[model samples]
Structures are given as C-alpha cells and as structure tokens.
Target: MDERDHASLPEGTHELSSEVSERVRSVISAAEAAANAVRHEAEQSAQVRGRIAEEEAIRIVDEAKGEADAYLAERRRRISELSDTVVERAEKIVARLDRAEEVRRQLQGLADSLGESAEELAAQLRDQPPPSVPQAAEAAPPVEQAAVAEPEAPEAPPGEEPPTGESEPPGGPEVVQLAEAPAEAGPAEAQAGDDRHEADEQLSARLVALQMAVAGGNRGDVEVHLRETFGIEDPVAILDDVFGPGTDAEKRVAWPRTGDSAA
Candidate 1:
C-alpha cells in the first residue's frame, strides 16, 4: 500500500481498535434504547389518562340526564294534581249556586200561595149574608109529636101479672127520652153570636190587607193569592165567582182548559 493511501485510511483501522469501537457503539446504542423506552412509556401514560377522562365524562353525563328526567317527572305530577283540585273546587261552587237559585224560586211560590188564601177569605166574608134569628114555635112541633106515639105495654102473659114498678125485661134495650133543647136563644146567647160575627168580619178585613200587600200591583198576582189562601182547588170556578164569564178579570185568572191553550 502507498503512504498516501495509508494516510487516507481511517485512524481507528490503522490503530486496529475493534474493542474501542465496539465500546463506543454499545454506549450509543444504550442511549438510543433508553430514549426509546422513555418515549414509549410517556405515550402509554397519555393514552391511559385520555381513556380515564373520557369514561369520567360519559359517567357525569349519564348522572346529569337521570337527575333531569326525575325533576321533569316530578314537575309534571305536581301540575296534574293542581289542575284536578282546581276543577273539583269549581264544580262545587257551581252546584251551590244552582241550589240557591232553586230555593229562591220555591220561596217565591210559597209567598204567592199565602197571598191567594187571604184574598179568598176576604171575598167569602164580603159575599156572605148576616145570620137571622130562628122562629121558636116553628122549631118545636116534630119533637112534641114523637113523645105521644108509644104503644101501651102488652099485658103480661096469662099467668104473669105485671109487677108493680117492675123493671124492664132482661137483655132488652132500655128506652131513653132525650129532653128537647129550648127553641129560643136567650139575649146573652144571641149577643155572643153577634160578637162572633163581628170578630170574623175584623179577621177578614185584616186578611184582605195582608193579601193586597203580598199581591203588589198586579191583578193576576192578587187572584193567584186569593185562590191559594182559601184552599180553592178549581181556578176556573174561583175566577167565575169573582169575575163573571167573558170578563177581562175572568180571562186573566181562569186556568187554561187544555194543553194547547196553556202552551
């Protein structure tokens, strides 16, 4: 080999240093291996941390969704309960109002009936004639004739003579003569009847005043009041007596004869 070639030759080759080169190579390889191991461990740790974070996030979301669903369900239940309570209370109020109206109508009808009764009583008192005294002699004839018609007692059978002051037969009904009442009333009795008549007239006048007040200004209302007061069953008959047929008052007070007219 030429000197120049020898000079260009690598120094380590000229020194024949295989062991040194091997040692240097081993040191470099060790450093590269350690660096690679560190990199691999760091990547694994990062992957594990990312997985844990993702699982935690998913679990948190699931818990939040469950809480939201429960809250919503409770809210809906409360709303339903409140709505039912309000509706129930409103129904009770409406029912009470209806009952009150019905009672008012019934009271009005009762007042109308009482007024009618008073009017009828007034009309009867106005129409009735004063009572007259009965004649005494004319009332006594029938009573006197009845006492004289008894037959004579039949003679006791042949063997039996009638015992003096004998009692009537056993089991036979005893005859009793009732004494007739005097035909003529005393002055005191006649005066008492007059007083009763006067009191009746006063009562009738008071009833008439009550009827007028209840009936107000309406003629039909007054007639209705009168019929109810006197227990008059027939509206037409009361109307006929108070106001003759074909009169306006009669037409107003008379009951309809048929369903068609009533309608």
Candidate 2:
C-alpha cells in the first residue's frame, strides 16, 4: 500500500495483522537474499573471465618473444655466413695474385737469361772474322762425297763356271792380289793423298756452313744450326765450346768434327 493510505489509518484502530506482516517480512527477506546470491554469482563469473583473459595475454606475449628471438638468431646466422663467404672470396683473389706474381718472376728470369746469351754471342762475333763470300764460279752447292763403292762383276750364265784364273777383281784390295794389275801405291804416298783428301773435305764442309749462315740472313741462324747439328741444349753454354781460346788468331776456317757431333 501507499504511504498516504498508511497515514490515513488511526494508530491503534488501523494496525496491520501480525500473521500478514510476518508473511510479508519473510517474503521480503527471501527476495533480498536471492538478489544477493545472484550478485555474488555475477561477481565470481566476472573474476573467472578476467583471470582467463590475463593468462591468455601472458601466453601471447611469451609466444611473440620466442618468435622474435628465433628471427634474430636466423638473421645473425645469415650474416655470419655472408661474412665467411666474403673472407673466402678475398682469400681466393689473393691466391690468384700470388700465382700471377710467381709467373711474372719466372718470365723475368727467362728474359735475363736470353739477354746474357745474346751478349756472349755478340762478344764471340766481335772476336771472330766474318765468313768470306762464296765465289760465283763455285756457287753450286757443295756435293758431299762418300767412299766410292766397287762395281760388282757380271754374273756368268747359270750353267757356266765362274772365271777361276787370275783376273781383275771388283774391289781395290782384290785387284791388288791379281798378277796383271800394277802394285798398290806406297804407304807414304797413300797417306799423303789421304791427308789432302781430308783437308779438301774439311774446306768444303766449312764453305757449305758459311753459305747456309748467309742464306738465312740473320745472326741467330748459325746458333740455331749449331744447336740442331751438335745437339747442344743450353744456348749460353754452346757459345764457349764453339769459340775456343785463340780461335780468333786462326787463319784457316777449318770444319771441326772432333766429337762427331755434326749432323
């Protein structure tokens, strides 16, 4: 009821019934307790939700930190690999430079050796007399003469007997054994003739060499020929052996084949 209705009632004549007031109070108390229980339950639900949200936020933060650390590690490893690669490339370049320097040094040594050889040859040429020009009358190239081979005798008919009597034989030694042939020359004359023939051969060989040297039209021609003919390996060492001591004083240009080194 309204407050006005309660104010209009006389104090003693309008008192509420005890049983009704008791029932009303019990109902009000029960409703208040129920409302309190609902509020407490709502507060507990809000606290549980808050705790879950906080735990979830913490977990997300931890996950993000772990990912960040892994990414940094990966980047650091890649940087280290790049550094190693750069160092390796630099080392390779250095190695190549070193090899190039070594090759250049070897080339310089070769050049020096060639220069020394050329100097020696120049000295020898200065000391030695120039080769004489070949005469036009004897311009035909020298013909190397070998030992004259004896002619073989004609064979007799297959059935006929060979000439058994003293007859002029084919070879020089055989002819000397025959009675009809003149006796062989004395040892002294034969030796003199041999000496003359040897001297002529030497002169002929020297002239041919001179002709060849002139034909090539270069100072190195003779050196090349000497190396090829005598099998001299080192270009520098061959100079000493070719220009002997006191060789400049020699008048005759004798062809020397003492070691049989000539081709």
Candidate 3:
C-alpha cells in the first residue's frame, strides 16, 4: 500500500483531472460575463427611467405654470376693465358737478343784482319829503285856533278881492307859500321823480334777466349759490328775488324746484 499503490493508479487520471478543471474555469468565465452584461443592462434601464421621469415632471410643471400665468393674465385684464369703468364714471360725475357749480355762481350773481336794486329803491324812498303841514300845525296851534275862530273874513276894498281860504286864519300866511318855500321841498320832489324812474328801469332790467334765464332753460341739478352763500333754499324763491315776487316777470320765468326741475 505504499509506493506500489500510487504507481498502480490509472495512467490517464491526472490528464482527466486537468481537462475537467479547464472546463470548469471556462464555464465560470462565461457566467461572469453574462452577469456583468445583465448588470450593465440593469444600470442603463435605471438611468433611462430616471431621465424619463424627470422629463415628465418638467412637462407637468411647465403646464401648471402656463395655466397659472393664463389665469393671472385674465384676472389682471378684468381688474383693468373694472378700473377703467370706475374712472370713466367718476370723470363724468365730476364734470356734472363742475357744470352745476358754474350755474350756481351765475344765479347768485343775479340775486345780488336784485338785492342792489332793492337797496337803491329803499334809499330813494327814505330820501323823499314828508308832509310839511303836519309839522307846522303842531307849533302853530294858536294860529290854527284863530283860523277856526275867524271863518268869515273882513272884506277888503272894492277894487281888491279878499283872499279867502278854508283852513287858514285871516292873519296866517297862505298855505301854498309854506308848501313851496320849505328848504327840503325841492330835493324831495327831485328824489321822488328819480325814484320813480329808477323803479321803472329796475323793472325793465329784471324782466330782461328773467327772459334770459327762461330761454337758457334750467339744468337737471339746478343748484343756486344763493342756497349755500345766502341761505335762499328754493329755486323759485331765487327767481322771485330776481324777477320780483308775484310779478309778471316771475310768473313768466316759471323757475322750477328740485322735483319740477327733474321733470
């Protein structure tokens, strides 16, 4: 069982073992190559999947952004339109108010003219003469009593007719002389005439003003500055002041109040 047993082993056993070992090594190399190829394919597939997912995410985000931008743009447009509408309406209202203010100023000017005319008329009347007889009689009551006592006058010479008077005494001065001789008589008469002429002129002027107002026609708002500045609230009353209350000019002008103005 020593050297002879070893020498007695088959002669091809070593060669067979070497051939089997080479075949196993070749199989292992092929298997390793197949596994590497599969790994490389798996890595490529994972990379491709990642790239596709990134592209899809980018597309979705871009679409969402586009929709949001469109929505924002539409909202901005609507807001702009609303703002324009509001501005237009406000401008129109402002224009109307300006026109009303102008009208009010004009009406107030007319009222001032009327007030001036009234003042002038009042001054002229105040300057006119009062009766002279009533003042003299108070101081000359004795003369009045004498005139009453001597109702019958003594006859003058045949050539001269006696001056007979109803209210005067025989010794008293003539009433006509006292009437004309007063210092204020001349100025009072002149003032009365002047006042009458001025009143006529004022009437004519007021008529003209009323005609102009009627011709122009009242605006819708019909505000008068007199209402604010002078506290004359009624449009009709303003017209009355301008045209003279209850006069033909006032009736012809027919100035309307707020409700009638709208009509």
List candidate 3 stretches off by more than 4 Å: 1-13, 16-20, 23-27, 111-115, 118-147, 150-263
lDDT of 1 by residue, 1-263 (tens): 68898789898777766678788999999999999999999999999999999999999999999999999999999999999998897677666556655664564566566556655666776687666655556555654554446455778888886866556443222222222244445445667877876666445534443435333433455456556654444444434443455455423322212232323
Give the clashing pairs for model 3.
Answer: none
Highest-TM-score candidate: 3
Write candidate 3's Cα lDDT for 145-260 as tens digits: 65577656567889986675664553456643454355435567667776776555445444434434544533222224323432334445445565455554224444334334
Candidate 1 local lDDT, residue 116: 66
How badly does each model clash, as a count of residue pairs? 6, 0, 0
TM-score of each: 0.36, 0.36, 0.40
Ranking by lDDT: 3, 1, 2
Worst 10 residues of 2 by lDDT: 139-148
Task: Please give the distance, in angstroms, between residue 119's alpha carbon in candidate 2 and its true position after superposition.
Answer: 14
Model 1 residue 202 CA deviation (Å) reads 20
Alpha-carbon lDDT, every model: 0.59, 0.54, 0.60
Our model 1 lands, by Cα RMSD against the true structure, at 17.6
| Better-scoring candidate (lDDT), 1 or 2 | 1
Candidate 2 residue lDDT tens string, 1-263: 67797778777645555567888999999999999999999999999999999999999999999999999999999999999998998788666666656765665565455545544544444465533333423322221111134455689999998877467544444433442222233444556765664444333333333444323323255446545643435434333333432333222323322233212
